[model samples]
Target: MTYQEKKSIVSLISAILIFGSFCLYMYPQYPEGGLGSAETFRYWGSFVLILTVVSIVAHIIISIIFNIVFRMTTKEKEPKFMDELDKLIDLKANRNSFFVFIIGFLLAMSSLIIYQPSQMMFIILIASGFISDVMGSVTKLYHYRRGV
Candidate 1:
């Protein structure tokens, strides 16, 4: 498989694993207060902020490791530049990812309109963010494999 395809697959798997493990680690730490309590909000707020930072750092580390492994195994240098097709594929992936996140955002809002707990809104938002990351990776993989 090509480098882009391999990278995309690694990204997809890493996103899933990082999110899953992070959620598992955080689950038991959830505040035991009432759902709408200040402590509960603080917990969810920290959850989202920390997840963002963790995901960014993990993806960067994984990308660097992937490049090093690819060089050692295949003896091929990573592409030095993004060509037109690469740019286009990336743009499409971003657009799709943004679209998914916006939908999630709206749904999260609607949860409030429907009188769901604030925790439910946070949950929807978090899940959407994770799904968007996965969607972007999948879009890149698909375009690379299927000719745009």
Candidate 2:
């Protein structure tokens, strides 16, 4: 695999792991009274801070491990720079991911209009951001695999 492809794969994996971890960590702690409650806000604040730190640490560790494995297993040297095709693929992937993010944002806005819950809106927005990131990485990997 090319360096860009490997990077995309690592990113996609990291996004999935982080999203899953956040869901698992937050699921049981969901406030019964809803997000508007002061207690719920406090919990969410702490959760966001903790999750951010954990996700950063986890991704860094995973990237380091993958780099080591790739170096050990691969005979060919890694490319030192991205060429035009890699840049094009990245641009296209980002464009597609932007569309995904816009859709997610619209959905979040609609939820706010219909449900009028600040807590749910916040959750949806956060989820949309993560989903967009994952979508971008996945798109990049797809383009790489397809030789686009």
Candidate 3:
């Protein structure tokens, strides 16, 4: 009902999404034939890799849109549904999250140049970005409420 409540709900949803993704990654394993371990490159390629790329990009875009809408709502004479604080926190987290991916990507490339790390670089980057975003978002919320 309150903006803080909305923010908390959104944060929880994001956390659930992240945890689910991790669970998907950590699903029970069995050895693969020649496709490589960690439960087949194809499975990784299909869901974890390809589907994730699309969804993550969509997530970013949706976040941006929601933030813009939240801000724009304030410009109207009518009271807005969302607190600007929520938008700020989300954007801060999103920005840091984007950089998280960038760093992960760069690290992946560097690692590949030497030798493949026997894992998909993209997955690591995505997971790191998600976790970092969550942490950043929570920190921002604390700072915001504390007026620090």
The candidate scoring highest on TM-score is: 1
| C-alpha positional error of residue 59 in candidate 1 after TM-score superposition, expressed in Å | 0.6
> What would the per-residue lDDT of candidate 3 be over residues 83-115, giving only the tens digit for each residue?
676677657756766777677778767767877
Winner on lDDT between 2 and 3 is: 2
Model 1 scores a C-alpha lDDT of 0.97
**Error in Å for residue 17 of model 1:** 0.5
Candidate 2 per-residue C-alpha lDDT over 1-148 given as tens digits, one digit per residue, 9 for 90 to 100 = 6777888988998889887978897889877875578888887777767777887888889877887777788855566688899889889888988888788788879987897776776677677778778888988999999878
lDDT of each: 0.97, 0.81, 0.59
Off by over 4 Å in 2: 32-35
Clashing pairs in 1: none
TM-score of each model, in listed order: 0.98, 0.81, 0.55
By summed lDDT, the worst window of 10 consecutive residues in model 3 runs over: 74-83
Instruction: Report the error of model 1 at residue 116, Å.
Output: 1.0
lDDT of 2: 0.81
